[model samples]
Target chain A: MAEDCILETSGLVKEFRGFVAVNDVNLKVRRGHIHALIGPNGAGKTTCFNLLTKFLEPTRGQIRFNGIDITREAPQKIARRGIVRSFQISAVFPHLTVLENVRIALQRKLGTSFHFWKSDRGLNQLNDRAMELLTAVDLAGYADMVTVEMPYGRKRALEIATTLALDPELMLLDEPTQGMGHEDVHRVMELIKQVSANRTILMVEHNMKVVAGISDTLTVLARGSVLAEGPYAEVAANPLVIEAYMGTEASGLASIPANDDRPPGPLPGEGDDHGSLRSNSGGAG
Target chain B: MSRRVTIAYLLGLALLLAAPMFIYPILVMKVLCFALFACAFNLLLGYTGLLSFGHAVFLGGAAYVTGHALKVWELPTLVGLLAGTVAAAALGWVIGSLAIRRQGIYFAMVTLALAQMVYFLFLQAPFTGGEDGLQGVPRGTLFGLDLSVDINLYYLVLAIFAGSFWLIQRTIHSPFGQILKAIRENEPRAISLGYDVAKYKLLAFVLSAGLAGLAGATKTVVFKFATLTDAHWHTSGEVVLMTLLGGMGTVFGPVVGATVIVTLQNELADKVGSLVTVIMGAIFVICVLAFRRGIVGESLALYRRMIGQKAG
Candidate 1:
């Protein structure tokens, strides 16, 4: 069980000035599992993602990737070590063609990223693989389209395709479906599941339905610390997790079912927008 | 390359080859020098998204180096030019290492401040001839062809411009160029994709400085002098104006921008005198207000729109 952990963070901590954004998080992600880190706003989920990817260095902790200490590694080195992250906002190169965006990732492996004098005609060989990745995300039809001109949800799909181009062992997705219609969310969720085969995904997701639908394990964070960790059903039913998510006033954990696609009751601090969610899902269906 | 673009390039080349017969060769050589300078500047400002406020340091610094080598050192023309380019590249490495540590306006400020320091150093340096400028730089022979003749020098400058232009074009389309555009579009995303963003930016800075240095070195050989005007902050500002007026990121934008600005400066310098500055300023204002994409970018956008409408 100990050896099964592909990424393990022991006593991870991050501080901005005097304020501790992520406080002492000890996380262990098993190999080849779709792990979801779900939390409300300001739960330091994004900060944790930043820490893992080395965008923000940990104030105190040891990040071990396959038992090697990576806490001090640079962000690009971490990426080169096969841990790639997607931005909260769709991260495609806006002016580049969709195909070109994916090709940029594929080009990294060609060992000629510094050969400025060579013609890019050599990169044409990468087009087939770029198209394959694009097709995987159902973006083959829009290969020639400038990414800025792409539909919002499709841009997210392209982000996934670009991330896939690196063939990362651990893919960190930050709000993969943050701003999406129900149909798009459902599609992205399906796409995430499809791409998660034989690879580990550590995603920071806010949408409960998407989290519940695909994730193999759940890590609930609140106030920058782990509140609960287990299977979805178990974590969703944990009293501390429920209290943290809904405040003390909410009862009956069954209201937020593990398998239900319909919008759940409004969690604490989020305004009552359940009606809009239901209507969006209904209209999309 | 597209057939249309290739045809345009060829026709432009032919026009330049025949230009010396009709126009003053010296004036054409001036245009070519500036055109190359602007193109090199665009590689950083346009493709890499780095706005260098101190690029005049490279241009002026190289001019002084070339002038000294030719006049004082009595070095061959090619060797002098090489020395100038290498010096600029070394300076670029030093400045770029520091400037890339900051980003955006901070990056610009760092480059600007460093350039000012170099400018002051050049002012006090004994070899530069100070206020008098480095005078009477020899053209010398290049591969047994005496470059003292205007036609011979013009052809050499043309060859240098064409070769450097081809190199820039190749870089823009290379694998490295793809990454550069990615960095320009979204830097953090590029970093997260496992790129050393700072390293790429520095390399780009060095390459741009080297090419700009080449242009300045060539300019010194053509005019037979290197002056404080070459390194002035105004020259830096002028290159920016040329890039912006021609088009920031387009392949041919800087060339067109340089020609227009240099031609206006020359034609108006004798007639309107210093008012040429005011006219250039007015043109800049109009360019920014009306065509923010500059001439080439706007034309391309318009052409694309027309083609899209027809296809649709």
Candidate 2:
């Protein structure tokens, strides 16, 4: 491990049954840096994130965060260690006010145990802190509005603010700009930069422009293995990267072609459709 | 919850507390007990979005414990209440841990199956007094103050009901409750945002179970009897009916539902007796299909609409 490395994984392997989802992944994320993982579909970017976050255990290999092994820690335990994740789909609490959503996350980080008699100390401080995060994301004005009522771009911003509540040392972002309009993508990219100023970040992104715009180093994966690893410019020009990006749909479909062309399929009463639909949707790739 | 909603709730609670003067104290006691039970159940179903059809296990389990403590052990009333609550809390942890592995419909069925197991256990267990139940248990006193008089018992029941109601309102207002709501709305998103959803679900379940136990414990002492019907699946359906009719997520919704349903049962007890189950099932369907948000929820919405109109 290098002196500046904040998160590192060595020989990471994750398998389902006999099939490999993430095969022998080795990577390192430097402190106070924006590192992006860009790979084609079925490249196992999400599986790697899941394994590292302890949502799923690896078949083999170890992950170290801030020089401590976190390969086997529980998901919440890993979160308590100051690592947090952001999803492509917004993770903000929709029914709660935007401020309340972030404040709840902040309260959780402050160990807000379930109690019927406690005072509102953590709650007040958390509310203030959530406002600060929302301020950073330019969402402060919408603080009291229900998150679901907010525009989509603002909702995405709320997710980032909530993730920031964990006080993360290493932030794992899974497709931060998915399904965004150009303005939202640009805003999210700007927010990501502001967030990374105090943390180390590892992201799996499909949008090349966003990756190139902010990433200090970029790691590319193809078919569950590292294809290239370097700065965005180097990784962008790599022949292997281009091949993998273009080759993705062919190999991805071969493994589960039935799902790609199959109709919405029969209802549950049809029997065989249930088993097939379950298998198809149950994570083959 | 909105500010106007809170104001409306306080108004409703005031009316409910005053209702015993008009209605029979026994009727008020029954409603309060059932209301507490439903409110506790709502902590899980409403906030965490996990439905437990086996809550009778907690309700009935506490009834048995409190009944046994009062009858066999001759314990103080408060001691019986605490014993019942602790027993139910422990049971909730065990059942919740296993049931939480599955989600949605599976979770419901798992709870239902587990409740049936508890039902049979009560049916066979000696301490539960089998079919006859533990009869003639004493309400005794609040620290030996002789709560035997109906008026005294009414106040005691009122205090317990109010305390439970306040505790639930406070719990939902807490940050932990906010997190539970988040998990209910979007569990995978909550997990990605670093919450251990299973832990949240279990915590909500345990809290709901404990309060429900409190309700059951008080009920046993109130009526001075614990019967097989207390632990029956009908009771489980009864609580669900109350929650649905009251408002699944709103604080006062379950209380209102409980009061109305209990009153309906009291009215029908002499007329159609055995048909209570059929009527409750029908209400459940009607509530789910036609009036999902419930009476209090609907009332709150109307309040909001009025407020909006005033602001405009």
Candidate 3:
């Protein structure tokens, strides 16, 4: 592992009932860089992201974050270690106001989470900072609005703003721009760019435009393994990467490519591996 | 605060103060106890998204402990209540630690199973008096004031209920309450935000259990008995009905639910006799089918819709 790498994984594997969803994968993300993991639908990108975030335990391999071996750490522990994540579904407290959502994130730093008897007024101290974070995300105008009422693009923005309130060293975002329109995609890309200035980012995104536009480093996964890794321009042009993208439509559903069993494709497997991968990929990635 | 909520609370306070004059003090006390019990249960079900089907154990179990201490050990009234509250909290910690290992219906099942175990233990245990329960427990004086009189006990019950209600309100609005709501709204999201979801859940459970015990202890004092009725699974079901009927997530929902249900039981049990259960079942079905959000939730939604239309 390089000294500058903020996150490193070696031989990471996730298996369910003898079916390996993510095979032996070695992923290293440099500090202070936006690293995008891009792959075909069944490439195990989401699985890889879950493993890194400690949401799913790896069957084998070690994950190191900031020089700490975090393979056995819990998801919340990993989050507290400065690696916060945003869900693909725009994880905001639907009943809470946008400011309350951000304030909940900021409250962890205050170390009064267990102080149940204290008046919530003590949390008033954090309002200015929470507001600042919302303002940074262009959500200050909607501070008092309950998050469920916010527009989809704005919800994603709120998710990012909440994640940013943690002041994390690394942020893991799964499909930050999934299900977005042309304009939403553009706004999120710019927001990611802005937030990436101070912290490292590891994201699994399906949008090729987003991958190409802002990713400083790209790792291509197919069949739960890293098919290629390099800068966006280099990896995007690779024949193996081209082969992976060709069989699959740019619309993101081009079968599993499981039969090819070669470069940029899933290895030949027993029948019915494709059954849940679609749902898993959609939900996880 | 919304104008509606403030007015409702004021109305509630007035009703509470004037209730003993019109209604039987003991009946009002019973309602207050159940109301507190429902509110405590709501902290988990409404705000934390946990459904515990065995909460009656906490309330009933505390009643037994307080009755035992006050009657046998001859402890002071306040001391006996504290003992009951502590006992309930400890039980809650144990049960919550185990129950929180599961989620949704599974969590409810775990709590229900544990409560059944508690029921059997009390049934077979010597101190509980088995089928007869701890009977004719004394209602001691508070400080220097004698609490044996109906009026005095009413005030005491009112004060305790108000304090518990205010505490619940404080908790819901407090930072810890915010986290509970967040966990209820979305667990994985709260976890990713660096919250130990299990810990928050366990704490909420303990708090709920402790408060439930307070209600039970108070009930024991008013009724002068801790019986099988307190610990029965039927009691657990009744509290769930109260919360759902009032409004699962609303601030005043549980109290309203308790009032409506207790009134229904008090009035109908006399005329309809055993058919009260059938009527309650019908009410539950109607609440679930028509106003799924319960009375308070539906009213709030309606008010919001009206206000939003006017503003727009």
Candidate 4:
């Protein structure tokens, strides 16, 4: 019950048919911190994120944003409540330009108006703000470009700026650095860090190194349940994690050193717990 | 706006305004009515990415309603117009609710099925006069003056066309219109964004249908008849063809498309009465393949790109 906890999910559960995708998950995201959720895979990280954002309703649970119950609110309503996300896939309007895409998001944030009789270009505040977000993401140079023509990576970056246009108090990044080369990953990581300076950030990432490099606190999920949760150092050295990691990837992966420079240990449980849950389901289902 | 576009719009407006003097006023009125019809249809197909084969329901339904009001009840022109618009909106509400149940091509089938039902209703309804329809209806004065003359009727039609066009333009630029676009682009995402996507879509459909009724209302008086042709599935097809030819989402695209189809029908009606159908089909194909954005959409896209490059 931290005074400044920005987000909290209590007993969150999402079940499909007879199987549970996310099971009785309890988590907290503090203010001005980059909280990373990581697991090997199928750790229910995505399902948890979906429930938190109200993109998917939980079968049973409570999602509170700054002490407000938002468990069953619509995604846009939740987004308007100051939580916004960038999807794993680029979700921009292909027909509109990069600037227009950002502008649409800005327009949504502004109150609805019946008077569109006048020119739409006079909203200098929105344009200036969108331009700022584009610059922050290092995409100011491509503002005028039609979204469809932009390269894949730039499109992804623009998606982040679009989400930013909603003026989120808590930003949800679903694999922000995914599908990138090392250099691009580094640049995005820098952008995320800069953004996290003001707003709270919660991310579900597969990259263990990036997770460790950014997260202030971490939660590890396995089979829709918490396997471990805490600061990066303590969880990395846990023996249960090593055992879990080794049994995954069909290759029984290499050992993560107990004292390795493994980028600060993204969240406590990291990928080990996620690997175990999905693999076990393969036999059960 | 680019100088060419500004000049072209002005020139087109001038030509349309002077149409009654050069062309038979009745022919000019026909073009304007159909143009408005095409623009109304575009609200759904182009702006909302909905292909409604049921739009003839609005056009024809309005005609029948206006026909009854003007001929049977002898109501004034305003009353007839209101009757048509209200009937269209009612039909739009029911059909939009049902048609929106499916998406993509399936939605098209649903609307087409619904429209066929409406066509049958019009065929059997007592007010429709079956095959004969309502004939020799008066154009009526604005309030008390007789607009029975060709010049007065032409001006009336032109004013309706201009008002409907301006209203539609305003609708597209509104917040609600933006939500519809969001639905068109990605329904699931729009749903996730918290807007009741279906409600927004339904409203657009109803409004489009109602405005289309206004066009149909004026058309009945312009031709001095209300007939089965107004409700024909061919009418639906023709409207769709015009929208596709003009580009789905552009403001003036439907107007230009309507004018082209109307002019084509006039000139080509002599050599081959039905050959205009073939020509319209060909134009639709050419527009779809070569200029998928339509004349206005492509031009706007180009303008946007050019400005984007300049900004860049």
Off by over 4 Å in 2: A1-3, A119-122, A247-285, B1-17, B143-145, B188-199, B309-312
Runs of candidate 3 exceeding 4 Å displacement: A1-3, A247-285, B1-7
lDDT of 4 by residue, A166-269 (tens): 76899988887666655566677767877787899999876656665767887877778987777766665556654554455322222333232444424444
User: B1-312, model 2: which lDDT tens digit per residue?
Assistant: 457657876786687678778988888888889999999999889878989998988988999999899888988888899999999999999899999999999999999998899899999988888999889998888855787887788888888887777778777777677778778887866776667888888988989999999999989988999888887988888888899899999878998899899998899989998997688778889889988899888888988999999999
lDDT digits (tens) for residues A1-285 of candidate 2 = 346888889999998999998999999888998999867568888888888888898999989987888888888788778888876676777788888878767766567755545544447866777788999989999998988899888888888888888778889988887767766777788788877888999998765556656788888887789888987556655676655544433232122312212333232222221111111122422
Please tell me what DockQ candidate 2 reaches.
Answer: 0.33
Local error of candidate 2 at residue B222 (angstroms): 2.2
Candidate 2 chain A, run of 10 with poorest lDDT: A272-281
Q: In candidate 4, how many Å is residue B202 off?
A: 3.8
Residue-level lDDT of model 4, residues B62-160, one tens digit each, is: 988998888888888888889999999999999999988789999889988999988988889888988888888877777665778888888888888
Clashes of each: 0, 0, 0, 7
Per prediction, fnat is 0.86, 0.41, 0.81, 0.27
| lDDT (tens digit, per residue) of candidate 3 on B45-106 | 99899999999999999999999999999888889989999999999999999999999999
In angstroms, how far off is A110's CA in candidate 4?
3.4
**What tens-digit string does per-residue lDDT give for candidate 1 at A14-40?**
999999889999999999999999765
Model 4 regions lying over 4 Å from their true place: A3-5, A15-20, A41-43, A113-118, A223-225, A238-285, B1-4, B97-102, B143-145, B174-182, B186-196, B266-312
| lDDT at position B20, candidate 3 | 88
- Model 1 residue runs over 4 Å out of place are A1-3, A247-254, A259-285
Instruction: Residues B1-312, candidate 1: write the lDDT tens digits.
Output: 456766887888999999999999999999999999999999999999999999998999999999999998999999999999999999999999999999999999999999999999999999888999998889999999999999999999999898898888888888888889999999988998889998899899999999999999999999999998899899999999999999999999999999999999998999998899899999999999999999998999999999999999
Evaluated on chain A only, model 1 obtains a TM-score of 0.89
